[model samples]
Target chain A: MSPDLLLCLLAGLLVGCGVHLLLARSVVRALLGFLLLGNGINLLFVVAAGPRGRPPIVGLGEESQPMADPLPQAMSLTAIVITLAMTGFVLALAHRSWQLSRSDVVEDDPEDARIGLRAIENDMSESDFHGGVDADPRHVDPDEAPPGTVPEEDDGSDPDPDAAPVGSAPGEGAEPGVPGSDDAEAGLDADRPDHVDPDPSTPEPPARRPGQEGAL
Target chain B: MSGEMLHTVLTALVPLPVLLPLVGAGIALVVRTRTRLQRAVSVTTMSLVLVIAITLLWGADTQGRLLVTVGGWLPPQGITLVVDRLAALMVLVAVTVTFAVLLYAIGQGRGAMDRESGGNAPVPIFHPTLLVLLSGVSTTFISGDLFHLYVGFEMLLAASFVLLTLGATIDRVRAGISYVFVSLASSSVFLMALAMIYAATGTVNMAQLSVRLAELEPATALVLQVLLLTGFAVKAAVFPMSGWLPDAYPTAPAPVTAVFAGLLTKVGVYAILRTQTLLFPASPLPDLLLWASLLTMLVGILGAVAQDDIKRLLSFTLVSHIGYMLFGVALASPAGLSASIYYVAHHITIQTTLFLVAGLIERRGGSTSMSRLGGMAAMSPGLAVLFLVPALNLGGIPPFSGFLGKVGLLQAGAEQPTPLVVALLVGSVLTSLLTLYAISRVWSRVFWRPPSVAPMTEDNRLERRYERRFALAPGVVAPTAALVLVGVALTVAAGPLLAVTDRAAAELLRPDGYVALVFGGGEVP
Candidate 1:
């Protein structure tokens, strides 16, 4: 049971554990784990190069025998610098993520999730259309927007007899005329009205008939 | 002159490709004003490097082999630079294409493209990073040892990560993160492979490894070979391990994608060629390599067939063409290796051209999706003509470089007198036709039809005039000129290039030539 052998085993164990933890959910824990892993490798490098020697920096012209290998120590120093920089960057990223989303659990980006869902729905509809089975839940009528607000042009062209009341974000099958055209504010606001929220709100339709909802 | 002095001078050359761009990049980075000056300096530096690389190639060809050991130490103790024919040729081609692309980037005018694309201006760091990347590729091709190869790979990877995520758009970010992760993972595997080879043979020097590897027990040697291949396969984007490339290549900024599509995977192919020829010639891996390449060819083309997006389809084609290069290497014959080398040079130019032109498509037609794009030919006849030439060449149309390269490979396969060779030949031909079909489909849909949706928006900023006489030059003209010229050169100079490739093939097949140069005493026989 040589001490050097035990040291190597411990370092290897630390690296394995550190890597495992680094892959976990908690950012702070991952950073700590990375530090431990780096230290573990540095220790392993020193031991593997050999043990029981004086430190490498020479003092005066003193007689030297079995000086410790300087290369591994140098490598460790570089590794430490790199690790420090990486850790700082990772911390910044974590902070930014928290500020943006208030959590660091690494959730799916909303827009990207929309795209992925679109792709999946496309696939589902494609298969259902081909298989001649029940219709896919994602099958939007060609004339309508895909479960979102319809464009203004669509609203103008396809007038809805039972449309929602005026003074709202343009919805599917709205009236043909400009809303509040007779009001003096129409000329005042050539662009979007000042009062309107940039992000349009879609009033959630009260629970629909299950059969109609599922028909998509 | 003393040998040490000459060696020092030569070693100085080893760092030239790497340092010059960094020097230029530093200038570009700090100099905030006078964008024109920055462009001039970057272009001048790159042009100088291209010239130097060409001269070096000439010297290498005439002088047998060029070895430059850094810091004056020799053998297993110091980093070495060995410029054999293959390395010299790689540096020459890489320098040529990189310089051309840089010119195109400058000529195309980032201001215009950014305005047209309705985006924030592109960072000037793009050119600097690209130049830095070329430096890495040049060194990777010339480095004499595995460790240096690993460093070169890292240098390239880091630059490529920056390139891939250039705009940091959401899509680009997602793609870039996956790309960086997969690449770094492969690199870690490469590092482990290096360690294993060093441990097994007690040497990492390519020259020394070449001689000592023969002495290793078959099993240990086999393990090292397989590990090395796996590491390279990830980089080479070989089938089954190549999932990352299709996602990554298309999402990058155009010029960046062009160079990456052009040179990066070829570096991996170069590594595989070098290692298999030098370190593991008798390892019984050639048969397996042939089969893998055959599958790569088939699977890659099929993947291309299934893709609707222009970039993804081209990416699949890029993956598939790698099989032909591997085919040449797997044959273990001079013709095969030489053809592969030639094909690599051709493929780099062709693939870069393809991706560059694809960028033009995105620029002129708006979206890269075939469904969204059409009537490019009617709008920009020059761009249409430019795209047609490369597209046909990519499909292995006669007299084009692709045809010549494929013919050379098929000839080598024919000489093998084995069923595997037959399959390789048939597979090569079939893939060529399938690829042609895909290219034609893209051509008809994108170039030959009326605009599918709305006409491309007018953005004068993106267009660059090539000449006063032709002042109405298409927006794609400057961006695609370099690639188009490369395609033309490949077609016109096919004879001379193939001859050079033949010589290279001969050198690779006969281990004696390479080993003798590396060992450097006299003839082994």
Candidate 2:
């Protein structure tokens, strides 16, 4: 029946609506819902605390009725300011996310999660885990290759625990070319770098692997 | 010469602890552009608070109890802040921990702060919000009225929302939302309980409640106790009500997590301790608290065991250790109260040190998961050593303060000589063993294993951007070293600290000392 109570109920309903929206998985909508919810709560404080009193002026005598509790009003003002600041910050973040991934919906970091799961599963599949056969494009067979011949991709796999990568590796796993052999060989033959084509005379592998899908 | 003058002055100091930060927060908000100025303000505000806490502690010890009625209103007429032995002790512990964490935050740089606030640079708002939260915490501990306590909780929670999700990322926001929503709900429950108590009794003053409790029927009192306890249990992260804690705490930035780890939940514990003794005295609630503490301990340590993430594991550990404080309080004896207070203090430093070191672990190792991180020892031996001290302290190894606190609690438990004691003692040992195991796992994965990945020569770009903005770095060696030294210092200085706690506890168990101080008149009983 009271106006303040009615306002409080309306604010409460808005808060409920906000909560419903927040529960949705869409990030932008959720952000909007949070904004609405915070506003609703701020409104409720105003209603619940009743209208602000003749502002608590020290030493002022002539005030009409029992002034409203200034505490809740002050609290509401503080809350509104904080919520606004938070909203602005959140919008910026949302905008950045949109720029980075082109959506406001939260995407699953499947790669990171899958990597985690893979690490856990490594113990169960040690035989397969170490095989590196998954796709070691630069892996040269140690038994067949000459000694001290470097693998093109270090791929950060430890050959020896103590050996630090001496600028020969850039991408955790990529090994730089052997130091002296390349430029000398490059200067001798303008057409070839020694690291890339050790034996140019050796015929290139067939363009298509035998029995591969859609092979020519 | 005059008792009234002393009471008035002591009461005035109560709001200062909280007001200073709030004023500082307002100033920080205005001067948001100047980062250095904000830092200066924040450091100065917190230092003032630290000094206030020390002075208040000395005053409370000397003057008995101090009461500050806001706006010069009398008790039950307006909000009253009361400083008693228990509350003063809490303030001391919180100040000490906050001081250490702030220093560590500064040393660690903007990177750490940025990580804490998500990706935002360390803004002036952080210092303001953090100070505001600390003031809330200090007031919550010392508040004489239940509603004032609720206000304190809200202050801390609102500030924490900003602290937890400073950068406002999706995950941090989600976590912050949960943290705030759950806390707000608990606060609502607390308010309802307060209303019910006021309806039942004519007053909300804690000391007055104690005297008035006996006149009320047992059932109504029990209902009030349970309702109030449940609300605080949510805050304390007690076993059944603690589901939200694990999900939210680990997701925050490290310094926030460290302080949250160190102090926030303990406020809930302090409330429970205050209520059980004052409002629901001689009830079955002690047994309930005992069971709750026991279950919380077992459940928390077990939860820690299941988590692979370092932060998550530590969060569980934080939950589990709360049981020790609850157990001490549940005993409802002088010795039990003192033991709980001492344990609460010791645990604050230890838990914070552990979490900060966890930050250092994340910094050096690049990930928090044990399996992915290896051989940090070779890269940062200082960090490795830093991790060792807190880890060992948490494990309750001897020659450390953690062991002393546990021993004190165990002694308190034994004094009761009941089945509850046996249960608590067993839980204590088992939890300690599990915690030790968890620490060892961190060490072996982080320190002992061969370097699996080459050290990162350049900082991660994302990490750098965060640092450039916030200056949040895990300046591990200094803050970690300082906290470690504090832990060791606690170990060495246990004699005097425990002595003070014992005296404080004795005063708390005898309510006359507090009541006389608060009402500013003769003994009530």
Candidate 3:
């Protein structure tokens, strides 16, 4: 077979494998799929460059041979750089995923899952029930409070039980909703005791459940 | 300046908008350790770029498409940059949005220590990468060659990947994965189609292709068009291919998400507008665009209705509204093109403003969920005003630019009188009503009702434990409020903006003008 036909077969096999791997649940596997796909495109660019020839570059005391089409080579190089950067980025992401969820497999997005459930149930209020304490690992730490927010008093627990997708910020849920609440703290502190933290014991500690992909 | 003088000057300045930000990105990266310096560099570069965009818009309107062939080489050989009215207007709005979002990010990043680090979140990457993204966008807007456009897309896509996963949390990483994979897939498809186009035409200059593409077999042209549109549809998030957007967007930092929602899709729309008009004016797929847009509008609005969270709801609406722009594209008349341009300008500002307001709601009201957020109108009247103005505008309330844009598009649709056009008109009206219904539901549940009751209390500040970060700063609210006012100002200045769009539409409908300016004698209007 001609080189073009052979290269086309190679690219096809690569794309096929890449697409198949893309459907896998594992994060690392998906990254591999991305690499394969990127490589296939680069190869196709080369194939599109037509019949190969000598290097396009010129050298001292020698006439340039019938030069290869250099534009596709340039295109291929750029694509490779993009693929490399993406690979590095994806690797970092996989590491982060491993640290957070302690699993390599990509988990279903919590928000997506919530929306799916809402669609199935056809009940908005029922979906709102899932708005309990957002399991975001970031807000569980006590030290995360914005400066001057009274660190000890600030709680990251859910203030509104019925709010779907409750924010994972500290001292949320039961907003005082008083005009100038934060600004008027100096004057309003005496009478603002009504909305103070119901449990001074503190918000729940960071839950580090492992092996389960959704657990964070 | 005289028209000739303006024309000559704009020719010189055509490449600066793309170049300055790139230089700034490099400089900012070099001095990344100095956070304040990096901020200054990014902001200053983008501000200058905004000025250039405005100047180019003035030049394009008074003169014509300003063409610059790089390094003294001419078109069909060297790369060309065409700063037409559509491009100039796009970059001007886009850069302004970028600058405002930068200000918002700067304000939000101040003084507040990261929750995890006990030190500040790394400022080095965000500012520099944002400048890189700006450069990429400017390149895309100004690029005249197809390969150059592809490079621009890659540049932005690379920068956005960094932006999307800035914090490196489980949520962000997950979203980033989907975003990256889909973007890669789209780029791959785009590359393949680009190769095919080059193979068929022997040149990738859009002007040259416009002349050459007409000679190709219709079947070949249709295949190429399908490949290109599929790639662009994924980028623009037109239904079906849009599944990755809402899932990937809401996880990023507010400013990043806002810019992504506002400017990125518009670039895709701009691509569709240009390629469809210039290369394939006698298209084989006008009906495909028409049907696709109708489905896009309906599906997006329906998704918005089902969404409980503000960010996701906005994302869905963003998808829905692209159909309105597509309607303009589908109609393919001067009126349709103008309406699309006007609608695009209206959408960019309003959508970005909405996301910024959502950030504020999350900050002050404790959550962006409608069910959790209530009585906010009483608590913070500032946030209430910020949210309502744009929310009303988004719902196509009267006198706002949104309403004006819709009316312009509807009138354009009415001109065709074809059965397909008639169905699209009805679909647009229905979509607008559904949009109103969805947004009003958010209004009632979020701003009007009494605050939800719960046992525990927490301050609504940026509180992720992964890093030290900027949460609620005094400066954050001001820029966002200013953006809302810009939304209102778009309404106030609707007269002139519409004239400009009408002219842009005229230019788009008459591709000969663009091709002439780029290749035929290069005369000023």
Candidate 4:
């Protein structure tokens, strides 16, 4: 029942190196780590199959000698195949990442990034009721704004409010010519005015109001 | 059929659930160019599997655990597929959900396929991969050997990697990378554990391990238990290991997200349940599991509260609810186990229904972001209703399966009323309240409020264009509604279902029946 020291050492080394590589940010490196880890486990499987013996072929070895357990070898073969398939899939994914963003370093989720920014700015308690009204005004378009409401630069302290709509113009202008864009935009435009009609009960707060930490 | 005849027939039917989908996947891949043929093959295969799963459930319930040895090989040596009530129930629920999701995906039509391929030549990868995933899931449920279970894990993981990153969009690719790495790491841990188990016991079969594992030194048994639990914990997205889920799942296309959200982690929970009950019946690590479950609940719900996107929010809640199952498992009582099994079945249907509804919301409003979505209640009352039932079901509202499952778990905890159990009870109740808050937040923002001007993000722009092309089809909505009804059905059928789960839990606690059945001579009667 004593496992081979050399084989155990090899498995340990492989697993150690594999884990180190897996923690890397690069997808390709992680793939390498996976392959190493797979091999390490495969080696561990070999060791776990018990002390080395004659090839597991029946009647090929002397009857008195013990045969190597064939089951771990079979299981490891399956593991090797799975590892190979996964490697191909990960490589394809890494390639796609490179194609899409010209980098293979896993990018942070945008929503997570936005949340992190909000945390850093100490603005985490913004109520869901504002309904994107308090979102960066840059997301809103000027022409879509109601006629009288369009010129509200009176607060003036935060430049982002008045400048947002002006900045949104070119983006909206470029989008209109695209097929199907109009129908989509029109549907939203119809909804936009209703959203903009300020709630008398909960008056629209000044754009970019300071974080109300306990708002929730 | 006579009782003995029925037993034989049922035992024979055991392998079909795994075999049929695989065969169907192969055929679907061959006929990939013909989308219609592929769809028919996929659906027909799953429908058959669904039928077989139902029969197996009946057989397992009446005739007791139906056992099949692959290639007619005997126990402790051959790969065994056992249909105990638990496995049969899992396979049945999983197949049902996957079948519905398949129909939903098909209803979505070419636009859905196009979204996956990013408008490239239609790859037809979806049907084949989904079938393979189904087969993998069945394999895990029925597998009676640890190595076979690992193979099943790899099969589903491989297929899921393809589904999750189907379009190769930057966001999906980013998410897929992390997902693939985490999954691979866990699989490695599982494989390592298998190695140690085999080395310690000289066999991988569950029946034999149930006997041999107890004879090992306490330290050796504890090491093996910790290793196996660690691997499953990662797969289950237990608190510390859960960071990858919200990031990865939200980026997939909606049906893909729905199925993954519903079934994948539950599969991990199933494995943990099976092992803890059968192989390590007197688990040395229930305290560890109890703590893990508590944190998984609290941390996951808090994370859900912070998410603005509907899919991401659901993803966090998915992680949170896995704790409930673990909570039941940790209690190590028949009632606890029964409640966990019921909760797993309930959560699978409810979670999938909600995600499908989220998909509907995305289509109707052109975004899943709570900020960008609003007025869905006014715009589409039917869609609002579709979203509401499942939302309340998930929030543990009275008369829903969610509430039933939680009440069962809490009642089980109260049986002991130890200090730790008391804390878990409080934590779980708190978690349920927070879940309601988060779900209600989604309901009001996405359905009730006035529509906001969504930012012109490139992703949603493309989404809107596709949404315009395929205006909310009945095909998509019907399957989602059907799944919603399925969740409601679980609530309605609670009496019989709980009876089945209680019987399953009783069998799980006593491994003698399983071990004897597996090793007892070939004649099932």
Model 4 Cα lDDT, one tens digit per residue, A136-173? 43545332331112222221222222122211322223
The C-alpha TM-scores of every prediction are: 0.76, 0.73, 0.84, 0.88
Candidate 3 local Cα displacement, residue B30, angstroms: 2.9
Write candidate 2's Cα lDDT for B1-525 as tens digits.
488887667767877877887897788777666655766777788888888888788788788777777787766556677777778878977887887777665555443344332223333456677777888898788788776787788778777777877655445655665565567556645755665565566566787787777678988888888989988999999988887787787777677789898988998998888887766667847778889889999999987766667888888889999988888888878778888888888888888888888776665444676644555665556667777887888899997888988888888888888987788899888999998987786787557765443222342222211211111133434666788788788889899878878888887776655566556665543
Query: Judged by lDDT, which candidate is best?
Result: 4
- lDDT head-to-head 2 vs 3, winner: 3
Q: Candidates' DockQ values?
A: 0.04, 0.03, 0.12, 0.14
Across all candidates, the chain A TM-score values are 0.50, 0.52, 0.55, 0.62
Candidate 4 per-residue lDDT over residues B1-525, each given as its tens digit: 788988889999999988999999999999887766777898899989999999999989998998899998887888899999999999999999999998888766544443333234233788888899999999999999999999999999999998888756556788899999999999999999999998999899999998899999989999999999999999999989999899999988888899999889999999999999999996647788899999999999999998888999999999999999999999989999999999999999999999998887765554687766565676677888898998899899999999999999999999989898899999999999999999998887777655445555654554443332123566677899899999999999999999999999999998978888898844321
**Model 3 DockQ class:** incorrect
Ranking by DockQ: 4, 3, 1, 2
The runs of at least 3 residues in candidate 4 whose Cα sits more than 4 Å from the true structure, single-residue gaps closed, are A124-216, B116-118, B121-123, B454-470, B521-525
- Give the C-alpha miss distance for residue A47 in model 1, angstroms: 7.4
The predicted structure with the larger TM-score, 1 or 2, is 1
Mind giving the per-residue lDDT tens digits that candidate 3 earns over B1-525?
676876789899899988999999899888876666777788789888888888889988888789999987788777899888899999899888888888877765522211221122353578878888988998998999988898899899989988888756456777988888888888878987887786676677888888788889999998888899999889999988988889988877778889999988888888999888888998837788989899999999989888878999999999999999998998898888998998998899889989988876766654566644555665556667888889889889898888999999999999988888789899999989988888887876677655443222354232221112113445567778788888888899988998998998888777777678778656322
Model 2, runs deviating above 4 Å: A1-216, B1-11, B115-122, B454-476, B522-525
Comparing 2 with 4 on TM-score, the higher-scoring candidate is 4
lDDT (Cα, tens digit) per residue for candidate 2, span A3-61: 36677678778778877877665666777777767667666555555454665675565
